[model samples]
Structure formats: structure tokens, C-alpha cells
Target: MESPPADTAPQTPALTYRAPTEEDHARVLAVLDRWWDGLGGDDGARQRAGLLPRLFFQHFTDTSVVVERDGHLVAFLIGFLSQSRPEEAYIHFVGVDPALHGHGLGGELYRRFFDTVRAHGRTIVRAITSETNTGSRAFHARMGFTEAEQSFPGYDGPGTTRVTFVRELEP
Candidate 1:
């Protein structure tokens, strides 16, 4: 098949980033569904909703960020400032559309989150992922987070061990 003329080809859509609102809950969940569709069998399916609850998104609307191109939710970072550690912020969940993986979207999301939190007077950012999630561990390292303390046994529950990572933001 012949390719379309240069001017006739569609232009890549520009991604728009903004703070997520309560209205975006459905779209965000749908994006998560797509991103985690086949990963963890029955256990994964059951735990997905609880992992990033709708109520958390509704409550922490300001700190969260979502990126979209055209009208779809392409990536998201759901996070909030820590009440106990006033200088720290935590990333509760973050996901990028599988189609956009390896294109630096994840780093962009983390950068945006860092900027947002820093603007709010947060000096440190923290996040956690499963011990088995090597991909996430590497990504966090690339984003400037180092393992915080030691891996926690059953941090998420009875059987889930999690690796916590922390990044100190510039004031």
C-alpha cells in the first residue's frame, strides 16, 4: 500500500496535562482497566478497584494530575500531601496507557507531580510498589527515587511486600 502524502497524514495529537477532578473518576478507572487488563489473574482483578479508590481521587483532587491527548485519559498520577509529615507528599497510584509506554510519559508525569508538590511546600515525595514489580523499581530509580528504608513485609496486606522509594525535592 502507498503511504499518504506528507500533508495528508494526520498530525500527532498534543498531550494536555491538568489536575484531575471528580468527574474524571470514570475515565481514570477505564484507563487503569486498560493498563492492568491481563496482569494478575483473579487477584489482580479484585484488588484493582481498591488500589486507587474513587473516594481518594475525589478527596485529593488538587494534587492529582492527568494527561490526555484529544479526549482520552492517557496517563495519570494520583497523589496527595501527607498530613503527618507536613514536608512530604505521597504518590498513591500512577499509570500510563500501555500504548504510550517507553515514550517518557511516566517521567513527565512524575516531573509534573514533583513540581506541583514542591509548589505546595513539600520537600520529599514518596511512593511504593510491589517487590516483584521490577519495572516500577527501575522507573522510580530513573525518576530520582531511592529505596526508602527496607522493603516492608506485608506492607499492603498479609502477603504483599512493597518497596518504598523516596525523592527529595529541591526547595
Candidate 2:
């Protein structure tokens, strides 16, 4: 089959980023499991949904972001300045429409988060992922996060170990 002319080929839609509102709770949850399906099976995805409670949308809207393409939800980054550690920020969770993986959407979301936190006086950013998640580990590394020497056992709960990452923001 012959390829379509360059001008006739489909173009990527422009993405819009904005702060998530309380009303977006349902919308994000609706797609959370499906977006995480590749990392975990259906059952795992269902369990993962519980990890992101409604609290992020309710209280962290200022630091959180939702991304869309043509009015459809495509990605999000839920993060916040550390209440206890004034110089630190934590990225609670992030998700990108799996179909758009490798398109730089995730990196762009992270860069936005970094800029926000840096403007807030945060000197460090931290995040975590399951030890089994090689994709996340690699992605974090690519994003300039340094992994801890060892996984933290029971970091999430009994029998759950997690790989922690930290990055120092350039001044």
C-alpha cells in the first residue's frame, strides 16, 4: 500500500494543560485503571485506582495538572509542595494516555511540575514507584531522578517495596 502524502497524513493534536478541578475527580478515576492496564492487569489496575483518592483533586489543585487534547483527558500530574519539608516537593502520581506514550507528553508534564515547584522555593523533588516497574524506573532516570541504593521494604504497606527517587532542582 502506498503511504499518504505528508500533508494528508494525520497531525498530532495540540495538548492543553490546566489545573484539575474537583469535578475532574470522576473523570480522572474513570480513566486511571485503563491507563495503568499495561503496568498491571485488570485486577491490579483496579487496585491502583484506590491509590489516588479524591483528596488530590480536592486539596492539591494548585499544584496538580490535567492535560487534554481536543477536550479529551490525555494526561495528568498530581504533585504538591511538602508541608513538613518546606524545601521539598513530592510528585504523588502521574499518568499519560498509553497510546501517547513516547510522544514527550510525560516529560512535558514533569517539566511543568518542576517549574511550578521551583518557583515555590522547593529545592528537591521526590517520587516513588514499585520495584517491579522497570518502565517507571527508567523514565525517572531519564528525568534526572536519582534512585535510592536499595528499595524500601513495606514503604506502601505490608509486603510492598518501593523504589524511591530524588532530584535536586537547579537554581
Number of the top-ranking candidate, with lDDT as the measure: 2
The root-mean-square deviation over C-alpha atoms between each candidate and the true structure, in angstroms, is: 2.6, 2.8
**On residues 68-131, what C-alpha lDDT tens digit does candidate 2 reach at each position?**
9989999999999999999999998999999999988899989999999999999999999888
For model 2, what is the error of residue 168's alpha carbon versus the real structure, in angstroms, after optimal superposition?
0.3
TM-score of each: 0.89, 0.89
Q: lDDT score, residue 133, model 1?
A: 71
Misplaced by over 4 Å in model 1 are: 1-6
Q: Write the per-residue lDDT of candidate 1 for residues 5-95, one digit (tens) a residue.
A: 9999989999998888878887876666568754566676566666877787678978888898998889888999999999999998998
Steric overlap count per candidate: 0, 0
Q: Residue 157 in model 1: shift from native, Å?
A: 1.9
